[model samples]
Target chain A: MSHSVDTWIMALLTLCVFSFLYRDNPFYRFAEHLFVGAAAGYLLAVQYQNVLVPNMIRPLGRGNLLPLVPLALGIMLLGRLAEKTSSASRWALAFYVGIYSGIAVPAYMQAQIFAQLADATKPWQPGWGAINSALILIGFLTVLAYFFFSAPHRGLHGASARVGIWFLMVAFGASFGYTVMARVSLLIARVQFLLRDWLGVLPGA
Target chain B: MDEALDVRWFDPNRINLLVGLSLFILFLFVNLRRARRAPSGLYIRTLPALQALDEAIGRATEMGRPVLYLPGLGDMSEVGTLAAVTISSRVARRVADMGCGLLVPCYDPVVAVLIDSATREAYTQAGRLDSYRSGTVQYVAAAQFAYVAAVTGLMLRERPAANVYMGSWYAESLFLAETGNETGAIQIAGCDQVTQLPFFVCSCDYTLLGEELYAASAYLGREPVQLATITAQDWAKILAAIVVVAAVVATFFGYTDIDKLLKTS
Candidate 1:
């Protein structure tokens, strides 16, 4: 067994969380609440040190006025706390949304649309590659058809859209399988930590 | 031979992108004008998940249990969060109209404020301002698993009849969904996160996949400008498809011009 106090506390919390698999209980609730409260406190401290201190406080202390713009915007965001000043928060929200949208639109167009189209339109090699290329083209077109809201799915469009659904389901299945494997790996890691690090039962430990 | 690297203020290679964006704007403007002239003539296909939203809320109202909504763990910068906020506004409005209890637990403080504002507006719009509760939208935690823990705890304790999750999600999607499932809540989840879609699909009653999440506001709002945006997006997709086909055809014929033209860098 581990003699370290931190290890003991962590191992117990892990067990408390695992208890939820059987059913929700006081131990699990205690662990959950503790984690949430600790996390919220930790986040506040980290943000103060990492973000507010360096970006706003330190800069202002150094007589840099540029940071004041963002600082003012942030304060305005806090105006939502009171009903009388709540509408004032919209200016900050609008600025944030507008800047983000302007940046995202061009980036999305370039990366998602243009880059993807460029790759999809690349020349195929020979033989089997050509067949794979054809499949890609068909899948792309059919999926696009499925997402076409303006057009009603009927006849040829409906068939293509149906095929698109099949493609989507296959994708979802593959993703689900991949994610399950990842979760299993995580579970194995936790089990290893419990057995080796805590109990010192594993060969290396 | 020595050659100088031609560097300019702007890369000419991205001209194609500029042209495409211009066309998109043109389509949006034209569609907006058309939609304003005749909003009723436009047709948008029914999204089953969005359609089920009302049904989910109604079930919660009938069961006399609060409807829980979690706008996933994303800040305002994310488009998914914005879309989620829009849908949450609609949900709040409906909940107010039906005189049902509503709960919205938030991950981001900024998003909490946004949701609080939206919910208050929704209640006011529905003439149920008195029903608006101060603590309806609460900021739980910034950490992902911590937020999930708080939310799952709430779900178990409150036993909300309908659980609505919208926006960007991560690994906690399943944790939230499965816990809600255990509580026997009618779950309707929508997200743009590709990896979390399967979890929602398996656990929730209805799942909005990919672009469907983005389209929900436009579909539900049915306002002329919003519907026009949907139509414009369709047109943009059509244009992209045409370009892809043209480039492929051109490439098949040993002409690499179209391919090179589309390249970003």
Candidate 2:
């Protein structure tokens, strides 16, 4: 009876969410509000358990001064809660933004810029790969040219940017196809859940 | 075996680093030199999606509905989030100017605070401080799907006429855009995440592709340094293309020298 009740609840919630397809209704609002409240509550609980207890409460209780640093920053961050103390939050925001920017610059340069350049540069390997390799090189160069907004995209530059658009369109198209498949898979999963878990009309677990 | 991966003060074997660093320094130098000169000559090619910002806002004004801005789920650590913040400031300015409602729902409290200040400042600067509502910029939820659900619910309840999504988005990208679409709102979306680009393209009336997000932010900010960086990055990209061409040529002829120079971990 308990299992059947749980199944009914699950089915009802699912239907509440799916009703969004028709139009936004009271049921959807309930589901959405429930989700937001639950998420916020969960995050608070997790932070208290994983972060506060482990890092702050326990360490500070044991007379360690280190946890005070993050605690101070956290308090400053919460200053945004009040309009008067809001300016104090900038100190923490700046600290975060500066550290992140400093780290991200070199990281992006190495990971995104340099690594991509290396892959694009190595066009020739062996066998029938030559054609694909050339296409990649051309596509890459053209795309790079397209992004150069400082230059006047006239004559040769215009032509390359145009080609770049075609390459980009093809890439976006392929991505869309992949994402559609992913979407369909999500649909399939939900259908399976409905059939097996909710209705018990499918095979046993 | 791991000797090749030894940490060094500076590894001479990694020529890619040298080249990248050189290019970066050179870009800085060029931008510095250019900054000393007239700003009038600095030109960026037109991006249609960026231009649609005003149009979308106008649509909302006409419909007597609010403009909803989703700064995505990215925290401040990501440049994408900063870019989104920059864009939000610009949108807030426009909305303030128009005396129209603008709602920014944030997944991060820190960002929510930052966004609130930006929006408030924009209103103040526009001499419309009275119109600035603190509740307009709100912290919704930290969790991904939760944020999505809350934003989608807001879209439904308010029936915002223009929905703007910017920054780093994930699976929630399509759901947000599609919800806005269903609401008959004119949606404009931009993200650095390539995977989410296609979804935005499908559901959004205008979508900024890749670094256009950065470029748009810079364009909107109108900060000389940011503008300089964008142009400098362009020069670096051009130089990168040249290097790629040379490297490919050398590789075609079975020369390992160029290959060695370009190899990175």
Candidate 3:
């Protein structure tokens, strides 16, 4: 109930986790198991409280027969834990997979492929933005051409795909540069932590 | 200002200083008295493995086989992806030197483009201006398994001598490693994802685990600022650990009042 006790408890737990860094000793092992156990227990409690009782049983009790479908699905999902009824879990898995695939496939197609093409093709009207747009179009067409698998390597589409390949190459190169900066930042963050907080020799601290 | 800093239960300033100092002293002692000799590259203030990366490429070139570089499954926003790309720059340099073709398969569009630039820059820097081919780097599907299938196909088709997998990965870690193994390529992998390490360790020749993935840039001497940051983070971890032990011992001995005071203070 007390915030101070809670804080100390958290600090102890954190220390247990950090203990692993000093060569995987018993303290780290104990902490790791404790964390796994606590997490599983908490998840179980939350599921029962949040999902099963309110969404299924309560609705059934209120005479909404429509709740039977969800109730059945919920029970079927629990089949995963029982060897005898494990086959029933397949339906639940299928339902989940179907929903996920339905949402993801279309979303990815629209975002990564078509949208990129649209952005790549906007005609420039003799301004800086237009010039950039034209450059982007050239890059996209050449890069896309390079990736072309179905069409012959002789026509305008082939030529555009080649250009798309070029754009893609440049894009990947820029991405590589940005990635260098990001990784370097993480290393910098960690070093700063050690020097400023751990060693106290770093002047900026 | 003095009174404002003197809150007992929740004094951020004092707690920060105490935690900072405690960790600093611990590591200072450890580093000073360390008698255990680690693997030559692992214990150093600066990384030595990075230097050998060029050698890996040279060997690949002598063998007359393509080099396979995987930028991982995530976007450039991921720390692991960034490390992979940074390492890729070095690898690209070596590949250009050898005039060996470099094949980079990307799972993210943004990352795909970034790697393309890095490949070109490395080639240009090596004075292989005309050698930079756009087709060498390509984007596979963003779907994890689809990306895996495409990469596996490339691995089979190219039969690269050296395989480098770096960045954020998930279920496909084993798939890529096992495929690379089948081709008998010298595979080096690095990932910050702890769950994927066991797979990489089992499958790859050299595996960089956890924080090591983040340290790649520093290891390669990319920036001095990164070295400073890592030192600071390590200090924070050590200080936090000591406070934890003290709290536990205090609680066990029924010094609940003292623990409470410390926590609240």
The most accurate candidate by TM-score is: 1
User: What range of 10 consecutive residues in model 1 chain B has the weakest lDDT sum?
Assistant: B251-260
Query: Across residues B5-115, which tens digit of lDDT does each residue of candidate 2 receive?
Result: 665777666666777877787897788568647555567788888888999899889888999999988888777888898889899999988888999999998788778
For model 2, how does the per-residue alpha-carbon lDDT over A52-129 read when each residue is reduced to its tens digit?
998899988999999888788889988877879988888987887788878777667777877787677664857888
Candidate 2: which pairs clash? none
Q: Candidate 1, which segments miss by more than 4 Å at Cα? A: B1-13
Model 2: residues with Cα > 4 Å off, grouped in runs:
B1-19, B257-260
Worst 10 residues of 2 chain A by lDDT: A1-10
lDDT tens readout by residue for model 3, B187-222 = 888887756666776778777655566666655643
Q: Pick the candidate with the highest DockQ.
A: 1
How does each model score on TM-score? 0.96, 0.93, 0.46
lDDT by residue (A33-54, candidate 3, tens digit) is 5654555466568778998788
Chain B TM-score (each prediction, in order)? 0.93, 0.90, 0.74
Query: What is model 1's DockQ versus the real complex?
Result: 0.72
lDDT of 1 by residue, B69-136 (tens): 99999887787898999988999999999999999999998889888888999999999999898899
Question: What is each predicted model's overall lDDT from 0 to 1?
Answer: 0.90, 0.85, 0.62
